[model samples]
Target: MRAISVIVVLAGVLSCRAATPDLRFGWNEVDYVWDSPTQRESAIKSRHFLPEHNLPLGLARWKNKLFVTVPRWKSGVVSSLNYVDIDGAKDQPLKPYPSLKDNYVEDTAKEIPSNSSIVSVFRVFVDACDRLWVMDSGLADILGSPNQITGPSIVIFDLNTDKLLHRYYLKVTDMKEDSFFANIIVDVDNATCDNAFAYIPDLGGYGVVVYSLKQDDSWRVSHHYFHFEPLAGSFNVSGIEFHWTDGVFGLALSEPRENGYRTMFFHAFASTKEFCVSTELLRNYTHIDKNEAFHDFKLLGDRGEGTQASASFYDISTNVLFYTQVNRDGIGCWNSNKPYTPENNPLLFSDAELYEFPNDLKVDDEGTLWLLTDKLPRFVYRSLDSNELNYMIYSIKTKDLIKGTPCEN
Candidate 1:
């Protein structure tokens, strides 16, 4: 009887392990369609084009259009923000958002008349109210001696019309010279969009900036959790060794509570630990300096010994937080209500070759989770083997993945 009981317990454990679903492939070997030949020639004539350096980094879907941002960090600065039609061909051509004529097509060294538009967007969020909030880092040549041409700012546009609505620049006091505004998450009132809050992570400077849409004000919040763990900086991806000391790269917000508050989960890029703080504490700028505000932070748990992540998204429907585990070359998930343990948080999907570095993730309104993997390590350590399909975007049904986990209903 004892032997039988042990066998039953072992079988149950095996079943649970086998129940974790593999991420479904939506698109494979995706490639961006470059600007028209005439447009490229014109851009080259203006001394603002480079063919080899363009790389897609940030991604977000709005309605039938899928948006992508290629920052002016490593190479040319032609079309920094563009989108492709979802219903189009597999290798859909990317068209500039709003319109190509609206953007500054001059040289990268030249300044444009309107700083309000997206100078260089690293990440953008499409809110519940159909507004696209973009984080314009305003930095060109990010790796080769960064320069802050325009101050970092938050810009919002009506997704339906693609018209600019608001632009709030970060004050010098709110950001450091070394600041790299890479990721942002928005919290909006369900009924109204006026009362909204934005959280931007300054990955390079080691802090988080909180922006208030109602007040038109912003503040910086610093904590030890925002800094990277030095020992965790070393990384080995696809047999390439490299190191980065990025801090606070990813942020995800939980569903609003009964009191209309949410929990903010964030983590550093080069660390395995995750931390959380209440949105209530962050919204109260009037009392942010108080010691109580500092003490509200809680360490969730470590991901694993050498695991690191880039982008994370929380699906309110399933109460599951999905994140890109870059080192693991896959996506990892956890039920926010469950204890942040290895057993609770498991690798939902993994593919060393296909998921070289799953850099960004988003949960669309259609109940599908979208992912973008841009062989980032290969791009950085050595030149990307363009002949071998370097960048890929994939999607998986969120409910299908959470079925057997604690997030399941």
Candidate 2:
């Protein structure tokens, strides 16, 4: 009887482990549709479009389109903003979002505060209002040709019409010499969309830049928590090893509390600690010093070693925060209702091959958890063998992701 009971429990565990999500997309290197065969040939000939150099760092889904951002961190990138047809072939070339002319043809590097001026985009956010928020990093070749091609700005598009809505450039005061807006999230009440606010983290600058869509204004707030731990700067993803001092790179906003303000869960890219600050402070912009103080932010404790996260998303359905741990190469989750401890937050799954540097994590409108794993460390320090799969994307229902785990509730 004892043997049978043990076998039953083991079988249950196997079933749960086998519940991996289907691969939505896989690519050794991303390709795109050019205006013409001649243009494609010329771009490659000019060394303007190197397949291996173009890496997708952000992911967002809207209806039938999946928006991807391939930042111009290095040369050979043909398009900085693009999208793929979800219902088309499983493996297909990307189509520049909105139109090809807007992404590549125009000399976007100098077209500041314009729709056609997206030099490079990192991570994007699609709000409940069916609007896609594209945060242009402005600086390019950051790894190889670090240049401020354009000033950092926010380029928003109406997902409903695939048209430009607004373009707000960040003021000089909103940036530090090393500012790199790596990630962004939207705070909006769909019923009243104009009051939307965007929270963008300056991973390289070590601060958070807030923008008000209605006011057409922006501000940058600083805090000690935004700094990365020097010891945590070292990373080993798969077999590639690298060091990055990226601060405050991930952002997740919870459902509004009794005060009608949300709790923003954020962390540095090179640290294992997670912290939270109220949106009230960020949205107010009443005084920078008051909001930037330590008391304004609360430490959620350490997530243990080897859990430096990059991008995170909050699931309203489960009240769980899903994030990517680049060091561990997996996703971890914690129910907001529970304390932020090792016991409360556990690495849901890990795959060195499939998740060899999970860079983006998102919860779509349908309660699905979308994860993008780009072999970033290898792409930066070493080289990603294009012959082998170098980039992968997976989507599993949020409920399925936490099944049988402490976050299940």
Candidate 3:
């Protein structure tokens, strides 16, 4: 039997106890830039500029610019990838990364992938070599009615020059039906840049697809923990009750061990349990490890009741794991040096309103912890006030986040 200890906290008090800094940027609804005046006019004339329909899902930072992803889950998402200037005005409209031509378009001719055009993107990651790894879902209208436009692929770019490096489409054998490539992490050292590997989570298919840059091939891996926990699917955020069955939605890599392979900590969006596997095992796509794979994957432990998390990042500086506490409307941390349990893990800060439905969380190269909250339940089930802030981004240095707390070493 599992020991389940639940802590009941008053939402009002949690909201007051939040110490996170003010929102860096927020909007009633996000806006974007176009290639030209004609393109802007065309987008508006065709009813493809519905601001409220676009939803920001993923984020990554490279130096002075912060990259944000707006998935085509509904109509009116003109660009799938954009960036915000850290020194620019607050709530400024986002400019398309690279150019609007590289993003999505509504034309029938644009439905196919034409020389670097992206259908949609859900996640982006920047490696130590200053390369931005983009997970192009090749999908559109995912929230209302998901549609596959192009084959799922990874598009990488040289952040220094904003030039394309490589684009690899997944092997058909690697992508199962309903495979939603929602998140990705690039594992590569600066010395071995050409021999890189990417770990992508198939949230819809309940498996992870590994890609090799050197071999230019991909393979799929599965474990029972990739599936969602049905008992933990129920969610109540801001009085909006709903259920989610997303699987294997979060992945965080620790500093490399003595053997030079890192430990990957992952969790399902609909489950409270955290699990782990070695990078050495996942790197070998050629191996069929049905018998060996079972014992290779280990369960870390449950995070606690109603503590299902989304995006996670393992800070090498503090040897801590920071995650978005979705159900509790807060931010949480766990000192990886200790065991993964309720007493060892703590929800450091929470706010019923400010942190409502926190979606994406990331730790940038500067040791800053960034978070993006969309109040998604209100937007999906109820209605968002056009004049009220619905989507927001917040950031704070990791050192300050765990200075005196037990999260620090």
Candidate 4:
């Protein structure tokens, strides 16, 4: 009887353990095979290939389309927006249409200063009246002077027509506002107001500036909102993203000094205020020590002094940060200071554990994650899960994607 009781107790404990749910949160590596040779020479010799932008800064997805922006070094501009269509693919490797001639008509480039480059795409929303707002940070002089702008501001693009709608310049009459307005979060679909709100993480401005999207016919600010926190030195707040499920937004902040550390911030707004009252979601998150994690690298300063800079993310129902960096060996991941996973090492594309600097990443409505890789001939596609730990690439149809099926079929 004693032996039986002991066996029954052990069995009950095992059953309870098995019944508990497993929690798996985090990204695994994926590999993709392409019909086109990844060799730059082959692709270039085949067609009128544009320069592969290795510097990925921002990404946006809407209406079954993916938009990616990369810094253009030769042109001294940042209008490298590539559109990918997952709907039409004949072979296993989906062909990429790098030009606007295929689907949408191309428009004239709205040029900024020669040193200006797009840091990231903050928001992509079709307003109730039908307008697309693109918030960006413009540099007066990146290599020359640090912050010499009226200030980096937001630029709006009309989604239906792909035209330059408006540009919002940040300034104050008396003060010299050298704002590093790099990232933003827009609640375009707020329940309360006809006017949408924009939260700008101005690294140099030292706080967030809130703005209303409702504008006059002349493209002027009819009414706006601003929030600044002088005590927290809110200036270093760089990367901003929205996590809908968590009921809050996330901000990746850099240290004030060049040699200082970084943190992950959470901004929760009171629902009653319609997200008006913003407070720190997670203050000063120094989870990873700067020294141990980055000990292998010495900051790059050859052409320009490489500072602690630039970040992107992969939002798999949650936010996972992405950016580029140079390993100790001197290989540059767009020269940004994004973290490198030990399992997903940098500088290779396949087979072995390789890490490609994802300057921008997004998950379309269909649950497919798109990554804009920082390679010589920059690559873009949906990452297919090969197994629990491994990922592969594929170019599939939109119909199949919407149905939650892999395009390989």
lDDT of 2 by residue, 150-191 (tens): 778888998878889988889999988887776789999889
Candidate 1 regions off by >4 Å? 1-36, 44-47, 105-107, 406-409
For each candidate, the alpha-carbon lDDT, in order, equals: 0.76, 0.82, 0.82, 0.31
Instruction: Name the lDDT value of residue 168 in candidate 2.
Output: 88
- lDDT (Cα) of model 4: 0.31
lDDT score for residue 117 of model 1: 54
Task: After superposing candidate 4 on the true structure, give the runs of residues whose Cα lies further than 4 Å from its correct spot.
Answer: 1-54, 72-78, 88-131, 144-151, 163-165, 173-178, 190-193, 215-353, 375-409
User: What is candidate 1's local distance difference test score?
Assistant: 0.76
Which stretch of 10 consecutive residues in model 1 shows the poorest summed lDDT? 20-29
Question: Candidate 4 at 105: error in angstroms?
Answer: 18
The positional error of residue 120 in candidate 2, measured at the CA in angstroms, is: 0.7
Q: Which stretches of candidate 2 lie over 4 Å from their true place?
A: 1-18, 105-114, 287-293
Against the hidden reference, what TM-scores do the models get? 0.89, 0.93, 0.93, 0.41
How many residue pairs collide in each prediction? Answer: 0, 1, 0, 12
Ranking by lDDT: 2, 3, 1, 4
lDDT of 2 at 208: 94
Preferred candidate (lDDT higher): 1 or 3 = 3
